[model samples]
Target: MKITLITTGSTADKGPRKVAEYLQKYNHKLEVIFYNENELRQTLSKCKNTDLIVVSANVATHKRASLLIQHLKKLKRPTAYAGIYAALHPEECIKETDLVITAKPAETILELANRLENFQRIADIENLRLKFNKKEIIKNA
Candidate 1:
């Protein structure tokens, strides 16, 4: 499976970067791209081969996160949000993302990726919030 990690902000945060680094051990293809709004469209256009997208941002990059999620939604791709902003605002993040990843995301994201690839159950992933069904949103506590 191919995964894209789009980190958006004026300054980079450590958490998402660490998670990105950790994910490489799983041997799945991964691309970590630092995105500024100016070049976002161009960057995202190159993501045609991505199986999943993980948008990483913080409070300072709220606008970036929102913008990226909007475009990702338009593309109808499976998308998730990582880092502090998503953790702090799972409700808001879930509105835009297919998955809202809270807390440390590497292991959870790996599990999600593996499940997504193999068609295993996804709702059981730790710290991940998403819809249980179209009628209801599942927010993990």
Candidate 2:
């Protein structure tokens, strides 16, 4: 799956980088992009087909991270927040994201990805059922 990690502040932040590295190690096929806050537009553009978005609030103000999350929400994608700020203010992060990773961010994100993949599969099955029912109705008519 394609995962985007957007960090608040510069690339000097180690928290998000570590998360990205961990994720890469977990699944080499995973396409992960680490972007700074200033690259919001580029991140949004690349997120067209992204499966998940993880925002890191390392050393930046909560307000800045919140605003970034809000912008990402407009894309209607599943978003997760991490880093110390997220851990300290999970409630605030939760307000803007689907999940807040207080610890073991890489593991939590992988689990969430699995759940989402399964959910999509279930939805596909349901759609097939609907299509089959429609065909049966047409045959009866």
- Top candidate on lDDT is 1
**Clashes found in each candidate (C-alpha, N, C closer than 3 A):** 0, 0
lDDT for each residue of candidate 1 in 93-140, tens digit (9 for 90 to 100): 877766888876888789889999999888878888887555477766
TM-score, every prediction = 0.90, 0.72
- For model 1, name the residue pairs that clash: none
10 residues in a row with least lDDT, candidate 2: 122-131
Query: In candidate 2, how many clashes are counted?
Result: 0
Candidate models: Cα lDDT each: 0.80, 0.63
Error of 1 at 76 (Å): 2.3
- lDDT for 18 in candidate 1 is 73
In model 2, where do residues sit more than 4 Å from their true spots?
28-38, 120-141
CA lDDT for candidate 1: 0.80
